[model samples]
Target: MTVSDQTLSTAGTEVADGIVLTDVAASKVRSLLEQEGRTDLQLRVAVQPGGCSGLRYQLFFDERALDGDIVKKFGGVGVVVDRMSAPYLTGAVIDFTDTIEKQGFTIDNPNAQNSCACGDSFH
Candidate 1:
């Protein structure tokens, strides 16, 4: 498989096919990495079945790169996606918000035709 180093932009956020980590998101990820003190960790993003809307997302720090993993680097942070979950996560944007009302990483997935009420699961 070919990995493109080219960068795509959405709302000023850099992107790739499977996933895009925004500037704020990347910064947060880097900060978290520093806190964890683990250089081997990479952010893993995956799409899994069995949510109310038929699909759910899993995002976390992973130390192992499984077989068939698609790895990309964004602003010094490594993001990994497995082959199976790649298609469903294409054109997805990950952003971090620090608003007073809500503070966390938010995902904007164009592939999701429908999503559950809680915004955790999508089509």
Candidate 2:
């Protein structure tokens, strides 16, 4: 999809294609990128094995894109997902939440059939 600057401007507070980034999540990522002084970094999300549920979620900052990767932009941030993990992450939303009991980024994935109690693993 074609994302304009205006679209990214509203991303922190709006949901698009069933995916979204909360203000806190966006801010945290932006801050880290600023500190690193790298404007090429992108948020990379993927699904891998080795969890209780047979699959685990992976999130990190990356600067490279592989062939066949699906790239998306939101709120001036780039999101990259490899072909192998795209099916599992489609329609998933990434957000940040700070609560008394927990604080961090979270993924709301509709494609998940089962998730482990720890909330880090899914299948």
Candidate 3:
């Protein structure tokens, strides 16, 4: 696994098979962490069995590392993926956008055969 300071979707680096964190997302995460005054926290990405598409993604700040967790660092941000969710999230690229239509994080998952219209769940 390699970490790069460059933005995602470029020839920068690949941290894992399917999980790529874009530069914008990393910067946003860092900004959020600074606002929260917590430097020990890491971004936890997980897949839960719910949502309209049968599986939903969970992203949050967590300080604890559970067993079988895969941790990858991009710049000053750390992305933690659980063992079970790795397969489902493999080849997924996470990005953040702030435009007039959308203003939040987005996930692009190649392993997903289908996703809901709400863009919150996938199968």
Candidate 4:
């Protein structure tokens, strides 16, 4: 189903299901792609283990999708999540923020039963 136009910003973009891309995040990603001079790259989100909280978040730019990947498109951007990471990321919202103390992409995940104090890891 198409998202309601009223829920979108002036850019005519709608936030994805359980996900969001703040204006700051979208601009940052766009700038990065421009600087890299590669228009084919897309953001890939994944879950891995290595943090004190038991699970860690992984974000990267990739040009191709591997087997068993779930793909979602938002505002002309492609987001890919692998099979293993799907459950953990379900109902998660992704946003970008630029505050005096922090500046980067952030994920608001409802599925996290526990998270590290630094907010970099989850369980």
Say which candidate scores most in TM-score. Answer: 1
Q: Quantify how close model 1 is to the true structure by its C-alpha RMSD in Å.
A: 2.0
TM-score of 3: 0.88
Which regions in candidate 2 have their CA more than 4 angstroms from the true location? 1-18
Per-prediction tally of clashes: 0, 1, 3, 0
TM-score of each: 0.89, 0.82, 0.88, 0.81
Question: What Cα-based lDDT does every candidate model obtain?
Answer: 0.86, 0.75, 0.83, 0.74
Tell me the deviation in Å of residue 24 in model 4: 3.8
Predict model 2's lDDT versus the native: 0.75
Models ranked on TM-score: 1, 3, 2, 4
Worst 10-residue lDDT window, candidate 1 = 1-10
lDDT of 4 by residue, 1-123 (tens): 121222345453345544555565666777887899988887889999979899999999998868887766655566777878888887787777778998888998999999999898999
Write the residue-wise lDDT of candidate 1 on 3-22 in tens digits: 44576666756777657799
User: lDDT tens string, model 2, 99-122?
Assistant: 999888899899999899999899
lDDT of 3 by residue, 1-123 (tens): 232344344654345556888888889999999999999999999999999989999999999878888888776798888889999888898889899999999888888999999888998
Cα misplacement distance, residue 88 of candidate 4 (Å): 0.7
